[model samples]
Target: MEFTEPKAYTRSLIPFLDRSHSVAKPGFSRWLVPPAALCVHLCIGQAYAFSVFNLPMTRLIGVSQSAPGDWKLTELGWIFSIAMLFLGVSAAIFGRWVEEGGPRKAMFTAGILWAGGFMVSAIGIHLHQLWIIYFGYGVLGGCALGIGYISPVSTLMKWFPDRPGMATGMAIMGFGGGALIASPLSVWLMGKFASSTDVGVFNTFIVLGCAYFVFMMVGSMIVRVPAPGWKPEGYVPPATATKLITKNDVYVYDAIKTPQFWLIWTVLFLNTTAGIGVLGQASAMSQEMFPGHITPVAAAGLVGLMSLFNMGGRFSWASLSDFIGRKNTYFVYMCLGFALYITVPYAGGSGNVVLFVFCFLIIVSMYGGGFSTVPAYLKDMFGTRYVGAIHGILLTAWSAAGVAGPVLVNYIREYNVTHGVPKAQAYNTTMYIMAGLLVIGFIANFCVKAVDKRFHMKTDEDKDLGAARAPAGAAQAVPGRA
Candidate 1:
């Protein structure tokens, strides 16, 4: 005898959160997807503005100054470092799951972790426990960052196959621009909540956490993947593919084995390493480089301006890549970056504040461009089938650069000062070293060739190997097959 499932059991399921629930029907606007992606990216992008909290947190107990028991700057610095460490780790570990599970599921999970992390950190603040904050925001929030970051990438690429670089630029640009909103918003929130006795960090965390969750959920609700075999109306495939742009698909795991993968990885690593060092120290570097010309307040403004350049570069450079090609784009970043880095020391020594600012603005723009361009680069090399997952693995380069860049900048400058170099010129040696690193990046970019055919997926089954992981009936539920 056939039995019907209980109504209560059926009611227990939340179909809205499923991957199939998010597939777009015929004529759904692909334009809607980038804003949805921005929802997740802008919120996660707050990581860049997290430094705003460091001083306030240190003053929590003291109210206006450091108390004997308050956390030190060195210790608090690890909050961001740990978050970045796990950002790369979680992305690499969960990337394949994100690829198979779909953007909606990944976004839902990210919203929860991202919001929950802030709540947990708020509790940590209430208790004055640093380690708890680390676990909450650094580890858990970082996982959210990794998931949220990659979630929209492949979806955007799929939606705009004709212009993958431009599509991704629109989404990733939100991440770079997130700091623009977060810095001021965070400061305002802290101001409103501040009192004589309370520094308001806890309340700020609680409110920001709740607010970010709402926005991220909206993104999740709005996002939809394209139907299987869907292409833009009137779009034409490139009749003749270049060696660099592969028409073939590669399995996620096999793509890593190719020399091209490592070469591209090195290209990203060196490029990131060269710029990231200066990005963190921009304010200090500017002030030291042009002592009388750039004040502390002016230095802060320079940092904010760099954020804009960084944000603009993500969209501009990535879109340019769609036209000029990804390989040529990196050639520009490395070549242009090397010249700028070499020139920075001279700009400082000659007291040319205008030239110094111009140099870093361009350099930081390329730094931001490198980030947004790589997903499309991976798409070109490995094929779109597994570009998101492959991109996730590649972010380990960023995690490494996060540590390496800061350490190199901080220690080198310190060593120079201790050895009798003037404060104004301490960064000169570091600038030359960065220029040298960019040369290595250029060579690595030159070495990148098309992925060998052996790395290509041989069967349609291999290409869609994990498609079964999708929820049953998802295809039927949504008009979109993919």
Candidate 2:
């Protein structure tokens, strides 16, 4: 192999950290990319399980219970909300930067912010300050979440052009499943570190920060972009593009200007609102709806099972989308999701725990599938050129739903209960409302059509911003090839 002399002032002392330096060489296997993506996604996915820290944090001052000086649960709730809000804000703002910069740079920045967020939050807990935790995990860590989330998306799609859905599903699946590992690990860590005077929240944050940092860095190190014009062996380009799947690229800003963008945004917003509200209230809703049957322990178990369904749906639904077409896949989500949401209250009323559980499992799975499939959906509607940035803008729907879903569930349930609706019946209206939202999503999904060609990129330079260029003499990339 030929080697070039090192430059006097390299972009990074470790050259691989730089985007240009991280290009995969000839013979590099595309399969390695998914694990690299998982390293970052799995670590960032802990955002879902951050709830595990909420209760423990309340007892930090009291050790055994919430004391006078302990932080209130209401205050702690803002931490996740703020993190989520900033996640969307940062994604929308920084999407183009990430797309142009390459995954390695984005992943590196995400690693630092994410790990540092944990470290700073740990300091906040130790000092008994709440805003510090918000600033740390919320603003800083939230930025990390946004960057880490979209970094691998376009890269994966380019690498697996034939199976874009499945390729992205593998990476996004790690994000959904991250809570599975983090929830139990966090509880065990707190148990080990707890004593009469401390609940170990601070220690747990520190450990998690360090551990996540290492994993994210590893992902950054291994990540690479496919050389431009590279296609898998024996993979022929589609001679004629489908109505939705265009060969042309759309600039990121132009994508936002399209009606299709807003439609997809609304579709995502509604789908997430329906499920996220229920997801946050799952444990309490189960206990209240099926009182005397689902104990707190069992409700917690249900939450864990929902997590699995969420994780599985991301992979399964996205892979299925590859076969069925993205539009048909979303139609299934909206249609079937509407039916499932409608059944939840009926199942609860009939006191059929099995049916109730089944409804939610499918519902939560669709929620996750909505997330994983959308990237490919955007790729279908818009071209892959600015897909990552377009996806970043789309994530704002998630932030809006994050707030709307939980608020709707909590306030509506409270309104009913205060007005003498039985606790068991409080969620009936919420379920109906969720079903209605799914109906709106279905309408929005139906409204979607092919994007106009007027918005398409006209020139070759406009299509690719130099990031896709292959290194000289490098062989074309092939999936699963070593």
Candidate 3:
């Protein structure tokens, strides 16, 4: 079988959209790159706020207007699930493409798919077709999420090689914060467009879609890959690095084969599983645990507060990793997360809302920190040669946790209830299960070691040769592939 290639016209145009080939103008500041990445991430991160639409979408017809039997929460639930499923799948599949194409092309394509997904979903909603919404937002939008999420990571890593943790933390921090911005923005938009005659979700989708398209386009235009072999001024690599940090490059394919990669994968999976489980039920758990003390509005406030902590942790913990190292950072997440999970049940049982909220906030911050720090962790283990692809493959853990977290939490809670456990105590079992998962994650962290030297790429013979071909001063600055 033969595959068709992009036409010459398309091929020629790609360089314009390719970050690697773009000339870095003199006096170019690497700091500008983070904001560009932020633009893409902040838009796509709206996926986390999708639940905000669930209730409104269900009421698309009857609550205020239209015919009966519009959509159910279960059906709407599939929209979020499908989006997450495709987010992981697309990231894994298209990761190499993103690496090859460069950030500009990848991000531009992401904008098209992400924003286009919304427009398509708008049409689906306008026409009252559930499957259309699924395909539009779930399939295409999810693909956009995956591509957009990883597009900036490698670039940021390369730009801030001396502070990989902080670089990635900045961009991924936007993702955690994206929901904070979008949740309120979405509610306000829906209200502005809504009426007794219509729920206004369709129009809200169209507006957000167009707005995000324009915003993401700005990111694509602004983002540029570092000049070949570029390094920060006056920065030096450690002469003798710790065991957790590798100075070798492992190709993405080779990376997955390494025990280190799978260990990190397990670490990420467990951390996310524990964090997302609590997040999935935050509002409901708040109300159930302290029925008389917490109102519906207060529960919503609690969820929002957690989002703030989540966003803050991404920046703070990841930056802290720069000083402490990636392995130790995750050690903090797993160990502290384990302790906090154990405390949640006690806090909830005592009806101490302050204690309960405090424990969850810390847990979520570590959760966000886990996400922001992993790319740097991969860079430490495998090197920058294929960090993006490695990171993309690792996100499959997140996709799995997206499903597993909620299912595990919901099932345990439901089982407890069915067995006649009190509503407040119903979550006790789930909390313990989460703590156990964290223990497993802590063990995985303990197992992580530097990749074997044999897995490292030969800088002269491999892809780093391109950097060697660069002009003199630039060539010396480029670090050898590890």
Candidate 4:
């Protein structure tokens, strides 16, 4: 029997919380699909690494046509932040279309816009037209962020009901790696063509823009969702697994009213604020604090390594969470993150490269883990009826982090520089602030209770999410199907 989709009231977007988990199909293997999915994943993942572009992006603006706050940094930030900000907004706006279009279609559009954003940003950078950068990459990339992020996350979970943690990790890991890829690529291209020594910023922009456009297009064209009526081979949804909420009952408007979303939002915001501050300013921080010891290129490379940690943490650590449980994993992430923040500055100040690398990686991994573990967390709390939209909304926290991270890092750095505070001392103070924020995040994560009855669609069973947290069929899964 075909499962009937629930009708959400005034809900333009319907999340794919298919209740049947009946995934009662023939034999299928979840492992076979991730390689193709990874392509789409890495491209979307570019958002994670966009700060790599910020690498002297501020300098580029300073030299291009304007001064610091006048237009350059502001323009550049607008372009980048818009992508993140819009990801949440557009996901809320376009979620139903994603369900209708399926992963393949959603990813294709995502691929196009994502790559196109680079090409467009390249144009703005090349021509030294700041507004164009905002218009092209900002708006377009935002759309890509919304669609690309959602494309594989839920679908992969459904297909690999048995390994939701691992499957989702593989795809989201690419996002973590996107920065790793972009950092090296951007640096390479800059050195080859723009060469901070000679080519100036505009030429560097054109070259990297073309390269990213090409690289991203290759990924977008290849993305696909599993065939319908498919399930991971040997997968089985336990008889105890059931739905607490259905689509027809909850609307986005209805969702915001509940305490669950707000609490989750706090969890997301604090986690992101704690980690992203370092990520955004990693290269600059490294350079400023260790100016006598590390070269610009080495500082940049360290940023790339953090990206590797970011990417690896998503898949590696978060997959580990599946067995350990999401809450337990988060407890580790926030608590450890707090400790890491405490040490980062001392390591930077003492020029302890080894400690610096270790602390930094741990911090970045938690950043990635936060993203990877959240989907499962949401499924556990609010139910998946509006997961895509809920996930989208949760990411608004990322946008907020974008603002918070850059501002906190840069502001502190500026304050220090202006005051003649040693570069090393500047970030040390900020690290304390970040650590404090993370401590709050730790407490918040400890506080995340299941959704209250008011948030349930039709009944209180939603509050009793024991087996309801599961998805699709595992035992009946079929090869090449979801």
| Candidate with the greatest TM-score versus the true structure | 1
| Candidate 4 Cα errors over 4 Å, as ranges | 1-29, 47-77, 118-129, 183-231, 238-253, 287-291, 295-297, 345-351, 416-421, 458-482
Evaluation by lDDT, superior candidate among 2 and 3: 2
Q: Write the per-residue lDDT of candidate 1 for residues 1-482, one digit (tens) a residue.
A: 12222232223256676555676888899999999999999999999999999999999899989999999999999999899988999999888767756788889899999999999999999999999999999999999999999999999999998899999999999999888899999999999999999998999999999999999999999999887777899998888768899988776778888988899899899888887999989999999888889999999899989999999999999999999999999999999998899999999889998999999999999999999999999999998877888999999999888878988999999999999999999999999999999999999999999888878765656444433333342112212322
Question: Which stretch of 10 consecutive residues in model 4 shows the poorest summed lDDT?
Answer: 473-482
TM-score of each: 0.93, 0.92, 0.92, 0.75
Clashes per prediction?
4, 0, 2, 17
Give me the displacement of residue 452 in model 4, in angstroms. Answer: 2.3
Tell me, what's the RMSD of every candidate? Answer: 4.3, 4.7, 5.3, 7.2
- Superposed model 2: Cα runs more than 4 Å off: 1-15, 461-482
Per-residue lDDT for 184-290 in model 4, tens only?
A: 66677666665434334456555655555565455434444444555555666565533422222233445667776677678778888878888878887777777
Q: Give me the runs in candidate 1 sitting further than 4 Å from their true place.
A: 1-13, 461-482
1-482: candidate 2 lDDT, tens digit per residue: 33232232134556666555766777788999999999999999999999899999899888898889889989999998888888998899888777766788889999999999999999999889999999999999999999999999999998899999998999999999888899999999999999888898888999999999999999998998876556888899799889888887777888989999999999999989988998889999999999999999999899989989999999999999999998898899988988888898899999999999999999999999999999999999898867999999999999889889999999999999999999999999999999899888989989999999888775655344322332322211121211
Per-residue error at 388 for model 1, in Å?
0.9
Score residue 221 of candidate 4 by CA lDDT.
43
Alpha-carbon local distance difference test for all models: 0.88, 0.88, 0.86, 0.66
In model 4, the Cα lDDT at residue 39 comes to 72
**lDDT score, residue 297, model 3?**
96
Task: Give the number of the best model, judged by lDDT.
Answer: 1
The alpha-carbon deviation from the true structure for residue 433 of candidate 2, after best TM-score superposition, in angstroms, is: 1.7
